[model samples]
Target: MSSWNSLWKWGSVALLAYVIVRGFSTPLQPGLVESSPSRLAPGKHALTLQAVGQPFAEPDAESADFSLILRSGKELVRTDITAITPHSVEADVIIPEAVPSPAMDAFLFTPEAGTLFLGNAFFVEDAAVGPLPADLRAEAPTEVAPDLGFSFPYQPTIVESIRNLLWHVPMWFAMFFVMGIGFVASLAQLRTGLVKWDLRAEAAVRTGLVFGILGLATGSLWARFTWGAWWVSDPQLNGALVTVLLYSGYRVLRAALGEDERVGRIAAVYNVFAFVMLVILLMVLPRYTESLHPGKDGNPGFNSYDLDNSLRAVFYPAVIGWGALCYWMYTLRLRMNRVEHHLLTR
Candidate 1:
């Protein structure tokens, strides 16, 4: 027990250090601004340019010369942007001088900051010119573009660094992992009819539910920023809620059956059933149903796409650290359960 405690202590410190270093090193997604003349009165039209992203908070002095290219049909018409604010700029288009009706493509760049192509499509049309042209017919690849130059949003404080990912998805993984242990322990109790295994199973489930609730709360907060909703009735979201409720019901069953020897076996059976349902409901159903959740329905999963390589370096460490911390909590609960069992018998 002493050795395990020592190992956990050292492991936690190392994991935390790793999460902090990587968080600072990681580059967040760059913000984008798209502006164009969707409709025009057949005269000079202006397309505005804007800088976005967390970095925009401290605008780069070198960004004063930001340029945007406006492509009319197959030709590049406008090549320079008039900087208004560090975050915004304007591009003037001489109507007929550029193109009769421009099927536009907007591109922006700074001296040190590399290029960014706005994904939002825009066009200009005139009564004289028919449908302009679909010169660029290919889909814009929706992936993180290489940032030739950028900086972190905030100074990488140790807590903020590790907490970014820890404060997001690690809780879910920790909850899932602990609950999975309970599922297996419950199965063992069912097979051997052992009270010891039942106690372990109960402890694991109880600890897991705590993390599960935290995961949901954290996820809801992150969702508000990224998905624009506190809670959306999406597939993955609904699936997670159902899984949490199912486990809550497991505890309810155990409580209602106070002092019954059969309670353990019955709850064990139900744990196995609930776990199976959890997999099906949270994992399978979300993929089949349309979801606004970042990870499902063609949206980027937490790390696969949305999180860049930089984020991954910190995120994976946060998972390990949080997992270690959760295990610590589980061990404490398991010991408490054993103590309670002995007292009840005595």
Candidate 2:
């Protein structure tokens, strides 16, 4: 039983090591991130496109092996590749005199990295809406899905910051796990008025705060990368901040009422209240309001769209490993609390 009990410690250490190594080490699928001269007129012009993530072309890739196409409503306007590199492409594009729509989408066909695309990349202002001329049309090359090895999915805004899902989300999960323990221990303290139960609640809260702070820090970093702000005024984000603050009050309440005869009972009741508020702030309130978080009413979730198998392989392990580490910390704090209480009472 002792060996079995110790197994999770090693397991969590190993799993966290795997998550860190795999999550940061993986690259993203190659994609076109930006375009030059977004506003174009109906005429021949030079166009340049910038790319990110994995390399889009080989070191010695030929211009003939690349193709650039534009979609204007129903018409496909093919362009000529003037120059190409591993990271960018230059094209001499002929804007059709008449296209079905003014908004154009660009598709770059690489010899190996499949079809890279950007929606509404160009807008033609002085163009008429109609069928594209035959001279501007060309059949696009077949998509060659390159074996990109193991990599994270490429999101338009998220890009490299997508890796934070492994850290920010798992830290919150770990906080919730240990805080749930504090909730149960609080209930037990109230039911039996036991000193042990009070100690357990205090320890759980103390440990949970560590993960809660980590969650907030990591979440802020991801927000800075994706949202261009360190903090946003969204419902989900505000709720998370409030929840962390409330948990912090649990620690303050215990410290202020230090050594009182009613400290255990009073602290347990406060913990119960704080836990209830945590549920509302982080879970219930976000669902009823407009939230920027995925799976909320307005936003599309990542899991259904872009969170692929590569992400799942590391994400699940990250959740389990972080939860185990949180619990281990809680148990250590609980033991230390019991030792201190015994010494003080003697």
lDDT of each: 0.68, 0.86
Distance from true position, residue 61, model 1, in Å?
11
Across 1-346, the per-residue lDDT of candidate 1 in tens digits comes to 8897789867976997877665556554344454644554445667665546434333356644455665555555443344446456566655442353445666665443455566433565554554333442223223334454334332111212323454557888888899899999999998899999999889889988998899888878766756667898888888889988999999999999999979889999999999999889877888888876556774435524334444555667788987887888888899999999999989
Q: Give the per-residue lDDT of model 2 (tens digit) for 1-346.
A: 9997899999999999999999888888878888899999988899999988887645354346778998888778888888877789889888867778999899998777778899999999888878888888878677878667787777788888888888988899899989999999999999999999999999999888999889889989988888889999988889888888888888888789988889999999999999998888887888789877776774435455245888899999999999998889899999999999999999
Candidate 2 lDDT at 42 equals 81
Clashing pairs in 1: none
Give me the overall lDDT of model 2.
0.86
RMSD value for candidate 1? 5.8
